[model samples]
Every structure is written in structure tokens, then in C-alpha cells.
Target: MNDLFAPRIAADPSGWNPHLAAVLADLATTDAVIAAQLSKWAHGWGAPFSLGSVPLSAVYATHVAPWNPPEVTLMTAKTILWIATVDDWAERDDAAPRGLDHLQEVAEGKAPDPHSALAGALADIRDTVLGAASSRRRGSLWVKATTALLAGMKFEHVASAQIRDGGPPPALPLYLHHAGQTIGVPLTMATLWASAPQPACDSSLARLQPPLESASQAIRMANDLQSYERERRTGDLNAIALGASPAYLRTQIADQVRHCLEQLRPLLTHPCPDAQALHYCLHFVLRLHQAGDAGHLHEREQQQQEH
Candidate 1:
């Protein structure tokens, strides 16, 4: 699991930005320097499993604000990098090793390690994207949204511990409720924070909480579908880990999609930046999953070798 990471839904080439790729290529030296200072890397970038997947930061920014200028593209990518970096290290145990301890400290407003490059990157991302007025308005909400995945990860940790001790995995109904957040709900909303600085973006997030949950659930289920066999073999938590009905997961995913569209359609008529960003997220992810999630390119590589 060290080699793998989350937000693996952006594998579709339709979301690829060749010029952006070139820009990232051009900035390779700069990224290398930053990576050196941080001493950490992200999937789809400098990490071990980056072969076929670009960092979520790059690919997700392209999908979120493709119309933005290059500068915004880079800024959003950095924020996404920060998200994935913290996510990568949040694990406490090797079996489903993701927790909220470090992020919890941040959520409580404790400064990260003073010399850590991740802290610097996070500050740069926030200062670059969040303006004074918008920051003031969105501070609490940002904290709330940023740590949204904590509970889900903590639950998984406990569940993993129980399973490790020969206890049963969590029940299907209970697991389904928190499953969506297992991969970090904030990733879905990071694009909103990346969106143009508008005070409306703050309230826009509040209004869209329902749809955001739906989107998270939908994405997690898509992951379940794609990683079911891998998870079954590895004894990881999965919707159908106990051999539950894939058809049931499909039906729930469809329901979530409907809920997202139904709730988002009304917001689209208005000019809410966060709503627009979420709309893009839901649309892109649904299309990607419907077509099939291919972001775990390393998995494909392993499969080919096995064959």
C-alpha cells in the first residue's frame, strides 16, 4: 500500500492536459528542488508507483479549472500535492494505514513541523489561493472540510485492528455509511478552494454539503468496483469485501449520482464557484467510473507481469 495512493479516478486521457504536462515537465527541476526540501513525494509524480498516473494535483486541477491560466493550474496542483502528501503519511498501521493524528494537529491550528517542506508547501498553497477576506470567511469551513475524512480513516483503523485480532470486519450497512470518506473527502472539495477567490465560494460549499457527500460515496464505490479483487486478496476493507453483491454497489452508486445531479442542477443555474467545481467533480468522476476506473496503472502493470 505504500506504493499506492488515493484519488486514482483521474486515469481517463480525456482529462489529460498535454500543455499542462509540458509545463509540469518544464518545472521538473523546480519540483525536484521542492521534493528534496520536503523529502516526500506524491503518487503520479516522484513516487514509486507513478508510472502511468500523474499526481492527483496535476490531473485534478486540469479537470477542475482547465479554463484557468497556467498560474492557477500550477497553484491548484500544489494544493492537491499538499493534500496527497499529508494523506500519504497519515497512516498509523500498515494494514489500512491511514489516520488523522497529524492532520488533526493541523486542524487544531498547530503549526506543522517548522522545518518541514510540506508545511511550507501548504502555506504557499493557501496564501496563493486564499485571499484575506475569503480566508476569513472560509477559515472554519476550510478546517471542517479539510478534516472531513478523519472519522472515516479512524474508523478504518479500528476496524483493521479488530480484523487483525481475528475479529470480523465491520458489517456491510455500517461500513457503507462511512466508506465514502475512507479516501479523503476533502479531495472532492479541494478544487473549490482552488477556484477563483469569491466570497460566494464559502457559502457555496455550505449549501453543497449534501451533494458533496453523495459524490464521495459514489467515488468510493467506484473504487470498490475497481479494487474489489485486490482488496479481497489483501484483506482490506471493501464494500464487497465479504463477497457482498456487486449489483448492490452499482445500484447505490447510481442512486448517489442521481442525488448529486438533482441537488447540483439547481446550483448550476446560479453563479457559485464551489458549486461549479463540485459539478465538475461529480460529472468527471461519474463518467470516469462508468467507463471504468483505470487510475491504478501499477495494478495493470502487475497484472501484465503475472500473465
Candidate 2:
């Protein structure tokens, strides 16, 4: 947190903040991995995301964990796309099977229902994360996060269905609280902690809980600010779609992000690898919004494959 207040260090590779630029140069290499895996994940997992759309490697992987081994990077990418693909599936077509009904159960090592690519992806991701976790604590955190994420999605899903059927949306306060989980930050962060084995803060899921809450809410609202129109048309749950003014939403985002950073400050003071990774995410997301690339925050917009 003090670093957020301090002047930028001269050593930052990019002129952006330290976390955003620390591994700035290496994101391209990870971009290659995201590309190659997307193709495989496309066919292999029946991924709802397109294989042709290239990912901004920074938003997906490099920004979170450039220091991760390629194998862990693969797992991280899988977890990300899996969550995004399901969210997309839910938004576009509710008639089809979501395959996410038992997401937490599957993530806990149950066999994915046979022939369901979405479930299979979760199973694979879980196996990889468990294998990478050096301690039971990390694995437990991943499961807890996954469970909470599923619960959040379930809450929003019901709200979407209600609105689609002509009912009123969830109350603003409840909607805002659950909205961030639908963006998938908690699950991804926990996965990173387990897979990258962010050694500095693995002792307890409690270590990251406060900042994680702030980051997730900030990210969810960031998307809501920009995607309100599309979401309103689709009858999906969004703060802006529910009549939150852009100005008000922006205030909420700033408050959440500021609170997140302050909570992360104490952890960052030590050599916590998890803090470092999450710090990068917090700043990169805000910068993305500032640059209008925050649409990438939604994940459905990334449609590229590097030649």
C-alpha cells in the first residue's frame, strides 16, 4: 500500500505502476501460450470461447503470474476461460445445459459428467491445481473460492432468469455484493495461489479475503460501467442495467479498488508472492478501464490469434 503512495521506481520496465510493468516485457511469451492453449481448449474442452480470438495475454495470465511455470500458466488460463465461457453460455442461451450445476463438486475431484467439455475442463483444472498445491491449505482455499463463486453465479443466474421472465431485478445492495463473484476473481485468485503456490501468503485464505473482496467488486462494476447497454438488452444483471448511474458506479469502483489496495498494503510489505500477483491485477484492471480496454475485463471480447 505504501508503494501505491510512493513514487514509481525507475526500475519498472513499463512506465506504468510497478506491478503492471514489472513483467511487462515477458507478457508476449505468455501470450503465445494462451494462443496455443485456446486452440486446444477450443476443440478439446468444447470451449464456448472462440479459438480465433486472441487473448490479451497480460489480462489473462502474464499480468497475474509471469513468474509461473508454463504448466501453471496453462492451468490459470484454463480456469479463466472456463469461468468466462460458462458466463457467456449463461448469457447467450439458457436453454442448453450449463454443466455448472455441480461446479464445486466437480472441482473437488469428482468425475465430470461424461462427455461434458465444460465439466471436463473443471475437472482437469482441479487436478492440475491440486497437484501444484504444496500444502493442503492452498487446496482448501481453492475449493472454498470455487464454492463461493458457484454460489455467486447461482444468485445472479436466478436474478437474470427473473428479469428475463418480467420480474424485478434483485435489490441493488444484494446485487452489488454478489455481482463481483460472477466476474470470477475469487476463483482465479485462489487458483493462482494454489497453482503458482504464492508462498508468501498461503497460510490462510483469510490473508487475501479483504482485498479479494474489494478487487472482485471493483472488477465486476468496471464491466458493468461499460457493458450496461448490451447487458440491458440481454436482460442480464448489471448495476447500470438496474439503473445505477455511470457516475455512481464509477464511485463504487473507485471506493472498492482503493479499499482493496489499502488492505493489500500490509501483505505487500512482506515478500508475499500472492500479494504481488494480486497487486498487479488490481492496477492493470484500473488502467484497462482508464484506457478503455476494460472491455477485455469481460473476456468475451478477446477474439484474436497471433500469427
Candidate 3:
């Protein structure tokens, strides 16, 4: 096994945020600097392998929320682990190499091969974040399998083995679960830290901060969706009060159309490749969100004319 493939232990037990304020302070002064830092680190981590396929940007965007499916929780944890590993190295001004060249260099550092080295790093990250215990191994396995695929690795045999052995899914780590509760805080702080205080370009960098701009948008959309759902329930209740006739069923269907729009608007706000990819995967949901509104309006017109 290559030294690079060896799972060296990383020290982040407390997972402290002491550097947050400093990062934000620096970013308030410079706009492109943090992005530059990320790019640099990506280079050092080595040639873009399948692991680079993990959508760090989307992870940053939505991973902070409570995931109904616990797999999402693990996915976020693994992605953050990768980011933490590379980000510190990326921040240095002296790191000259950029893009694919830098990644290739980093990948070539291993004795055996780049692919296996990356696989080991990924496996190490899973063990680190999930904890090292026999009880947790199953959960760790699931995360490792999913993360490897996301990063662009193929481990079909391992994945099939996991499915065969699976019974109940494991609980996500406590920190990752809580990370959703405090969703926008780190991202907001990070953006603030990385940006210059003054406007870096013609426009204010502060204005474009993802946390500042999108968090509120996300919250509002979430709220609107909730309200839409409540109203639909209320409409159903009213229909039941009137009696569940053909008209009542049609009314409930119309309600669904409006509810779908509320859901889709938030998703479209700041879409990236990962988000778009996920959206495509949820084609049925997307179709409902897109077509639902027009259908609702038409139904409303028909209902009004009949009345």
C-alpha cells in the first residue's frame, strides 16, 4: 500500500471554530482570496479523481439542514472532511500550482498509484468522521461506499455487499446532526472571513455573499412551502366539510399545483452543477413544481366560473 493510501489520523477532535473570525476578517478585506485558497488546496490534494466529484458547493449550500434520509447526513460529513483536509493548504499565497496540473502533482505523490491513494484518503476520512468502533463500522461502510461513488470511484462489489448485509440504517453523527441546526452560520462566517471588507470588484462582495443572500431566500422559501402545505390541508378540510365529491377531489388536485411552485422556487435560486444534477434526478418533483402553478390557475378559473 502506498503511504498516501495509509489512513493517517487527523486531529480535529473538538472541531473548534476559533479560526472563523480571523477567516471572516481577512475575507472582508479581499474577495477572490478565499476562492483562490480553495483552488490552491484542490491542486495540492492532487489530480482530480472521482473524489472531486463530491459536490462541495452543494454540500456548503444545503447540508446544514436536517436531512430526512440519514445518508444525506453522512454525505455532508464526508464532504466537509475532504474540504477541511484541503482548505488549509489552499489558503497559502505561495501555493503556485493551479487547476488540473496541481491535482495531478498531488495525485502523483503516492508510491503505488493516485487512484488507490485517493481511495485510502477517502476511507480514512470516513473512519475519522464516523468514529472507529465495530458497532459503527456498518454506518461507516455505507458512507464510504456512497462517498466513493460521489467522488467518481467505482466499488460495485463493496456496495453490493453492503446492501446484502444491511438491516436498519445507522444514526448520523451528533455533530453532523447539529450542523444542520446551525446550518448557515459557518458558511456565512467563512464567506465573511474570506472576503475583503471593502468592495473587491465594482459591486460589493458582501452583497454577493451566499450565506447572507441565500440563507434568507432559503428560509423564506421554506416558510412559503410550509404555508402552502397548511393552506392545502385547510382546503382539504373545507372540501371535506362540503363533502368529497368530484369537485372536492379536483380542488385538492389544484391545491397541489400551487404547492409545487413554492417548493421549486427556492431550488432555482443559486443552482450549481450538483444541485442541477440532483434536480434532474428528481424529475417528477421538478415537473410538478413547473407545471403545477399553471394547472392550479386554470383549475381556479374553472371553479370560479362554475360557482
Candidate 4:
């Protein structure tokens, strides 16, 4: 994985934050492999919701491993989307990253500041990927978050020189809301939800269908179709785990998740806006499935392909 996605450094590449680089390389491979596999699966199933989330998750695996700041911002944005789109929204929040204290520090741009380190990495990433256009420019939500973060920091003179001496950039005031908290550089589930726009009831309920229906049919499907239990276990586990609240709450939540899934399931048959959107959807479902169940959803898909 390291060899596969490792970026070539001009000199002493591996030595330059070797640990971080190794992690990044692993993430690149993981994401790429998952994305490639999922892409083939989507085509075969002719199902198109936001499968793009798989690649985005792969993208996130890179950010979380070594705590890259720019990647953190990207991860936060993705989390925001995930919480907004998934049923059992609260459960999604719990599974995602938390807190923005680091982001605030990044905005501040002080030396040895975790925030600064993160901010600098982001700056470097932007420069590498988007060129100088990353300098004080806001393009996408991620870019905007970066820009806002950079603009909000207060640097001491000593820290300022360190930045000149090749350190991380200052922090920003970017706040991603989650779990009723407004945090900077959100890496948590709460913060991720905090950053997302409020979902209307209709939208929220539509997301619940796949898991609900899949769960409901699991036993019957298993008896009628021997492979059904194994194949559907992932979705069932996710639904049950996420729906575990007070009895009344579970009922309400299950209803909503089922409803949402029903509404959106049809969209899976239609063309997605693009690969990114598809990837987003795929990533969310996979994550929920992975976190709540085992990797059965992905595994079953793979088995189907091999056969």
C-alpha cells in the first residue's frame, strides 16, 4: 500500500514525516481499492445512490490515521454529508470524528500548535493539488473551510517566523456543527452533524428504507433464499444497532429510516449526478454497515462478483 500510493518526495521522502507518509499511502490504496471494487459493484447491481462515499471514506482513512489537517477539513465536510444523508442520524454522529479545538488552533497558526500543524498540512495539500490557487482562495466547501480557518488565526511574532521557517499555517474560525456543539476542524460525529444543513423530515425519512426493508425481509429471504441471511446481515445489523433507542424512539426512528430508504432506493436505479455523488452514498452505507455489522455487505458483493 505504501509503495502503491506513496508520493515521491524529491529527497528523503520517506524520512520526511515517514510515519505520516506511510499512513497516507495506506489510505490512498485502501480508498482506491474500495472505490474500484464498489464502482464495479454499482454497475453490476445497477443501483445508484451516493456510493461515492466509499472513495470518500477511503479519502478519510488517509486523513484520520496521521491526523493531517487539510484532510481533516475534508473529512469533516464528508461527515457533514454523511450525517445529513443517513437514517439513524444520531448513530452516524457517534461513529464519526469529534471536536474542532485542533482546527481553531490551526487557524491561530502558532508553532508546535496541533492546529497549526494541521493547517499547514492542508496548505501543502492545497498547493500540491490545486497549486497556488489554494493561497487565500475559497473554492469548494473544503476550500472555504480552509480559507476561513486560515483567516481567523492570531499568530505571535515568534510563531509567525516559524511559519516562515516552514511550519503549519494559522487556524481559522471554521465551525462544523454536530450534536448541538459548534466545533472547529470537526473530527467527531457531533461536529460533523453540526456542520450539516438541517434535514427536512421528508429527506430524513427517505433515508431509512434500505435498512428497514432489508432487515424486515431478512428472515423470510433467508428461508426462501438460503444466501439471504448471510447477504443481508450487514444491513440488518446496522439497522438494529442504530435503531437501539427507547422503544418509542426506536419505532419512530425505524419508521423514518425505512421511509427514507424507500424514497431513495428508487434513485439508486437512476443515474447519479456523477461519480462523486455515487461515491458519497456508497461510502455512507458501507461505513454504517462496516461499523454496525461486520464487512458482510462488502464481502457478499465481492463473493457475487467472483462467482
Write candidate 2's Cα lDDT for 63-170 as tens digits. Answer: 677677877777777777777777777666664334456666787778887766767777888888988897888898888888777777777877788777888878
Model 1 lDDT tens row, 1-307: 1111134444668789898788757555444443333333343234322222334345665676544555555655555556545544443445333225554555546666554444544444445444432565455555555555556666766786678799988888678676766554454365345435666656566668789888888778877887787666655678887556788777877788788878898888977767777777766555555544335555667788999
| Candidate order, TM-score descending | 2, 1, 4, 3
Which lDDT value does model 4 have at 72? 38
What stretches of model 4 exceed 4 Å from their correct place? Answer: 1-116, 125-138, 143-177, 180-270, 273-307
Query: lDDT for every model?
Result: 0.59, 0.72, 0.32, 0.33
Clashes of each: 1, 5, 22, 50
Predicted model with the maximum lDDT = 2
Report per-prediction Cα RMSD to one decimal: 7.3, 5.2, 21.9, 20.1
TM-score of each: 0.72, 0.83, 0.23, 0.28
Q: Would you give me the overall lDDT of model 2?
A: 0.72
Instruction: Give the runs in model 3 whose Cα sits over 4 Å from its true position.
Output: 1-40, 49-63, 66-117, 132-138, 144-307
| Model 1 segments more than 4 A misplaced | 1-56, 69-72, 82-99, 114-135, 201-203, 290-294
Candidate 2's C-alpha runs over 4 A off are: 1-24, 52-54, 57-59, 95-98, 198-200, 293-307
TM-score of 2: 0.83
lDDT by residue (tens digit), candidate 4, 101-143? 3433432343323333233433333333333122221223334
Clashing pairs in 1: 91-97
